[model samples]
Target: MGLRQDLRRGIRLVKDVMRNRKAQGKLAEALAAQPPLEPHHYRVGVYFADGKVNLYQMRQWYKPLAELSKRHPVLVLSRASGAALAMLRESPLPVAYVRRVVDLERVIHEQDLHVVFYVNQNAKNFQMMRYGRRWHVFINHGESDKMYMTTNQFKAYDYALIAGDAARARLEKVLWDYDFDKRAIPIGRPQADHYSGTLPYTPDERTVVLYAPTWEGDRGAAAYGSIASHGVALVTALLATGRHRVVYRPHPRSGVVDHEYGVANRAIIDAIAAVNAADPGARHVYDDGPELGWQLSAADVAIVDISAMVYDRLAAGKPLLITRPANPAAVIDTSGYLGACEWLNAAPDPATGADAGASMLARVSEVAEDPEARARLGYWVERYFGDTTPGATTARFHDAIDHLMAEWERFAALHADDEEVDDHDEEGEADEDELG
Candidate 1:
């Protein structure tokens, strides 16, 4: 959902270059910081994303990544707009924007960067493995915290930062476990700031259900079914039943055209109007409004697919259902979507009609109405989102990151090519307005 594959704007590439230029301008900030690699002073180029599987998890994980890397002379490889960057500006790592991939390669030559770490996923990343000038490291973001969708170069990565023990070892499976000295560096995700916060719905207990799906049509992979329409139908039926209030939030990347679902199916306004015509009480929720706390706190039940919201919902220890069966290909995506993590729960198909849904709603309703179901979902939630003691978990994560920044700093002392960088950035300058 982060970067729409077919979107016309090469916005990200341009944003990345601008970040680099901004970093180049702040050389003074590094006066007290250690120098870079050799006569070239090769600085490690670190890039992060709004690229996590879900925007929520991306924000969830990146917050700490930024917090821990504050003292280093790291440059950010971002294509995020200034406004967009501001949201993430909390990051201490310097940013270096690149307008285009070809230009980015030219800038890499100019800046003499020796290493690149992407918290974001990229197809071009595989190129870094074949390259001789730099090294590439990958850190994928997710709720289950497993290493499911790693690239082909995963084993070649100098390091792979993960979140949970299960999350980290998933990577070790591919790269040789126990070879941490050479294969992987299990510095868990710094993005997880807190699983604690105010609840979205405490006193007000209307039956609430969250509907979130993923964006997949760019390559035509999303056209397999009519989940959007089916989802709309389900909402209408729920409203008619007058039994629950629905919070319908389509995937942000749903802007892509679907001949089957149609553009109208993608619009929440229509879905909202449809609900109002029916129950007249449903409310719309979003990233800005619900936040993670509210969504986890408010909902009586959550309905989702491979989207990371399931992870958040589980954190609430509330009733949950995986929405599937709308797309004809639902069975396949549900079975293998991204692998291990997706396997965490059961996905009920909405297309099985009201009978199937009623069955699920019954199960979720039990979880909502009965303490036993609530406790069971709670156990599953902990298995998914809960971790060790908060204090110790936070301490281990923060210290590990602080140590990373310090290690990065130590590496800078041995590098020497400053003038070489100025020459390299010339081609990498960004062209678009950056996201704050």
Candidate 2:
């Protein structure tokens, strides 16, 4: 029996390798076909080690990196293989894969990298941290009020590119010894400026409601996801109205932590599909695409979980509802928009019992038409994001980059003396050797 199990495992491993061989071949081809990278080719490098599983965390950086490339040569640096490598291939920005520490050092030197940005706090990041000259900036994937946003690990980076004052305040509260004033830079949300994407449905008189729920988090405090408790209830209520256009965009990691939550999410999606099929002209959407701006901008009202999606929609100054986490222990930061934003709480856990959607319909209807809720959005938008004028956020983002570049130059200049001294000592040693 043991021998048979071993044989089966070995066979499965072989089959897996064979299945991935084509993707591996494609990656090799792409790498070989890459144009010769000259010394000082890229100024900025976004280091992401999360791979394909957490690709969503890296996707938000695409548009911002694309725009930054226009001003300074920007490239994505990855050491991920297989699925991660395959996903990197599809990225809009140029990518360089370095597996070994020595290879990473070579790229850093050859590219004359001025700044390195990190999206997540992967332990592998410490490998890149060895390079002391370049500025390591922590530009997290999304902005949210979750405990993950204000982690102690934040102090690891030389600098952190935050969304706005709210982020700065969060860090200030948590990081006791760190210098918040000098290190934390408020660039606002750059992704918002590049909010250009195709909308599947045309503008109409129907109320377009975007229901974007985050995944059921791994821990209890982070378990703020509303898909199981509120998603079906809210979505069904809206669809039943017959005057609403529902757009369901569940987190990619939905059901990953909890299978039951995933089942609930799928049920809501299937319900939306059924609604669309019944009324062909309803144009209900199931957005599983990389594009986020279209949904945030197109929706008349957004029903989102207590996550970054809430803030992103807040930036649009739309009538948005934050689903109160069903978990009583969910941690919520009251320092920012979350404190003032309107909330919709579903009772009796929509996942259990009959006529679940009925109870939440009235609340959804009331919040959807609340003029007061719409009015309060502007004040919070400006407070959280600061100045929603046409290009204000983008300009602030560029300004932050410019400040960092100038600072890097000064830092390099100050450190150049030490480098020169080392060079002189080596030269003197060579002269002594020649004399001997």
Candidate 3:
């Protein structure tokens, strides 16, 4: 058994190496075909080091970054070949493939990068943060109440563009002696302003339900995934109801840590396919596409776990249900919106022996029609995102960037006479292979 496992691992490793090499070739060819980026053209830089697997982190920002580029030219400095290749094909903004430390330095030297944005807390982000004179800002992928939202890693950046009052309050409770007024800027959810993606199905009388669950976490504390516990049952119940259309968008990293979780996720997807086959007009979608906005906006009700999806749906200010984690060990932070939000449990009813799906249907119906629930949701929306008025968040986002740009100029003039220092030491540089 050990021998077989080792052989399988070796084969998988070989396949990964071959795939990466192919992607790198494609990236090189693509770059060679395009016009070389002009020197000092971009003022704003988005540094992403994660590969294709985590592209969702970057995909959500496409529209906002494209819009931001209109005023201040934006560039994406991709550190992974696969990510660079993918972004080069689809990203609205120009992409610079900086796979090695030396390549990264070249982009830094060329671009007048006044503000650099980070989407996630990828360890490789530190590689980009080491440079001085530019604002290393953390504009995270999404807004959420997960423990990840309050990590001490926030202190590492020059500033964090947070969501709103709730995020500030949440950070204050945990991060000690942090200068919130100076370091944290609330721009609301700028992505919310530009919710892209067209509707896959036409408008109908059927209630649309978007069930976007997070991945099975790497640890028990973060085990908020409901795909294994609540997903199959709830999705099944919704499909059985001819009046409902289920839009299942599971996290991109779903089931990476657990086999059973992957099985359940597949089951939900298969059920959607089968239901659609049986009724072509049902239009129950199993969306794994890069676009995210339409599902959030079109769905009559959304069911999400304890991850960023909860906050993403909340930003829509629509009626939604938060799936209660089946894992008792799963940590729940109720200090913010979770404390007062509606919850959907996986437990079955003793009287009816009904599964999670049946209960979910009832909950979905209740939330969809409840005026009181809508009112409550409205309050939380304002608390987390400030003004959901169209273009409001986008304006705030641009304002924040303008503020940082002005500050950069102020500091630049203050130390104009100081000797220029080269922070990129040869000893500190990692090998090209080490970057991946």
Per-residue C-alpha lDDT of model 3 across residues 43-72, encoded as one tens digit per residue: 999999898889999999999999999999
Model 3 residue 124 CA deviation (Å) reads 1.3
Q: Which portions of model 2 show Cα errors greater than 4 Å? A: 1-22, 82-89, 348-356, 420-436
Candidate 2 has a TM-score of 0.87
Q: Residue-wise lDDT of candidate 2 within 234-334, one digit each (tens)?
A: 78888888888999999988996676898999999899889889998898999988767888888888888888898888888888888888898888887
- Which lDDT value does model 1 have at 203? 40
- In order, candidate lDDTs are 0.48, 0.79, 0.89
Window of ten residues with lowest summed lDDT in model 3: 427-436
Best first by lDDT, ranked: 3, 2, 1
Error of 2 at 122 (Å): 1.4
Best prediction by lDDT: 3
Global Cα RMSD, each model: 8.4, 7.7, 1.8
- Give the TM-scores of the predictions, in the order they appear: 0.62, 0.87, 0.96
Residue pairs of candidate 3 with colliding backbone atoms: 234-357
The per-candidate count of clashes, in order, stands at: 47, 0, 1
Residue 108: error of model 1 in Å?
A: 8.7
Candidate order by TM-score, decreasing, is: 3, 2, 1
